[model samples]
Target: MQKKREPVADSLAPQYPIESVDNALKLLLLLGEQPQIRLSEATRYLGVASSTAHRLLAMLAYRGFVRQDPVSKAYLPGPSLTGVAFAIFGRIDIARSAAPVMRSLSEQLRETVHVGMLDGASVRFVAAVEGPAAVRVASRLGRAMPAHCTSTGKVMLAQLPQPELRALLPREQLKRITSHSIGSRTELETELAGIRERGYATNREESEEGVASVAVPIPTRAPGLRLALNAAAPQNRLAASRYPAVAAALVAAAKEIGDQLG
Candidate 1:
């Protein structure tokens, strides 16, 4: 018989699966894959007693791999955990993970689709798929756009704590990418409020002269990172009256991407 190699500390040797570590790793995967998870469900998923699950979660939380919601008692993926995930799963992997789903959504909606990640006060489009149409929103891959004017930027900004938002955006005269762009922090704060309630964000020719778009967040393995996928078209095609339906489509695509990641 061939000799088995000794597993190193950073090894992924499956032959030496340690029970406790395996269970905890599985739990971490679930946390990374979903937006929120409850203790009861976690226990059921792992076929463990509440005490056992609690111990695992408590250890993870202490390590900053998990965060428990104060009001709902649900668990959210923590910043430290996200850092680990991002380190292990590089940026290209994230774009690769969402590619097929982005294509599907673009075809379904007949509009240009983009996957972007927040970079300070801007959004960097990592991947894009164009739609089948004579006139459409142009591909924005490899581009960084102002955060306050794009749908992707708004959705990500809406989730930031007030202090963080202020730190990133500031209270000074905001850049005027277009006449329709949010002109001040006061207006942006009000707009972000509505975006939080609606679970999606929209841009009415805010970033460009005549582009309209809707976007939804795509929760990733990164804890502190914010990513969004958006569908965009000309203002006339993606009219104000069509925002509701467009938002729905974006949300649905985001959900599918989440499920795919899981």
Candidate 2:
């Protein structure tokens, strides 16, 4: 038997609250707890009339916060909601806690460092620190990029279970951001296997021209939390010969950040 899920607890009520707006916001928060919501479920959850729930959902759908599946008649997250979520998750509490460590890592490596989290098939850079070097890679905070094209994403993906990874990247033909980006899932899986064996991942002009990076997963204590630490620099500055040392440094820094988070 399945257990009934609990709704998120609310804080103190505002002095001038609107019922309609409050109901709509509750629906949005409900999405965070479940993959999809049926009209009946929303009605029951909100303890409101079916028609009222329908209207609220219709408005949310029109505004791109939710989209209803034609066949299933269930509401799922829309692009706008996803974008907003990614933006918020980029600056989540974990990112705040790891900022100083990430900054120190950038200063030590003399290269731009970033903390990225997986969001669907993309990686969202939550925090970044620019190196003091004059020609360093710039900060990528709040940017979402193709996961297969980045060391930060790849390192985290390599740690994900095969089923989850395949679900995130189901098709064989993957979208390429640059000429060097992996073009197929087969090739990406092969590289991921290597990343697993080496305990890290690397990108060499895969995400952008003349850019190179190394990343290791942050060992968070929280379950289902996937985050990585990466250091990026110019291809010449972050040469292949330096990968091992750079990767080692990133691994240590990632551990430090994780320990602090714990």
Candidate 3:
């Protein structure tokens, strides 16, 4: 039998350590490293008896921290854990951190600029700055839009692995925000493939009539979430001919925002 390895206590460790809490925390950390864990693997990892590992996993499941797949029977991060991660990102003050970069990009491009975070199948505009031009697109702050229908959302979605992306958008047909929105999962995947190759994404009046946008992903250290920076303008002002330049600007601004976020 393999011997159980104990965690080394440090200066901050409690005077009297609680093994169960320590083991549970270890499991959470393990989840961060892999996509899923089986009961047997957890038992082996915890160096505990099968029943002890089962009980720990059960308590974690009860608290909404982990869930077992009905088919695979492997434990995965649950909704509550995802919620906690978002809460931690919220405390990171992403909006405030991106504000200056958004304002600068808006001014430079003379178009509305936004910082958006991926939320499942949608993208939430966390911060926005409107352009000086009277005809520019309006701010999208605090609004959530279908991920496949907006450049901001698509850019962030492009960062996800294929399995995770498919998990998020399983149906063949997709909801459209406008006539221009991509209509099928296959079509969206095709475009996402191009987005991955080019390192950005675009929308031509997909989310709203007469509006166009280009977006680039904002690199983040966080494991579970992704973000993007976008520039939106009147379609006439942001034609396909301008996509390269607009995407380049968004990329630079995104890097700056990512630095601030860190």
Q: Tell me the whole-model lDDT of each prediction, alpha carbons only.
A: 0.81, 0.85, 0.85
State which candidate has the highest lDDT.
3
Tens-place lDDT per residue, model 1, 1-262, is 1122233689676776787887787787665445566789778877899999999998889999887766567787676876776565453465677888888888888999998888779999987998889898999999998999899999998987665677677666788798999989899999999999989899988999888899988865555667888999988888778888888888888877766665
lDDT of 3 by residue, 1-262 (tens): 2333445665476899999999998887777656677899999888899999999999999999887777678887777887887888978877777888888888899988888888999999988889999777888889998999999999887876566677789898999989999999999999999999999999998999999899998876554657888999889888898999989998899999989987
Query: Which 10 consecutive positions of candidate 3 have the poorest summed lDDT?
Result: 1-10
Descending-TM-score candidate ranking: 3, 1, 2
Off by over 4 Å in 2: 1-92
Off by more than 4 A, model 3:
1-77
Task: Decide which is better by TM-score, 2 or 3.
Answer: 3
TM-score of 2: 0.66
By lDDT, the candidates rank as 3, 2, 1
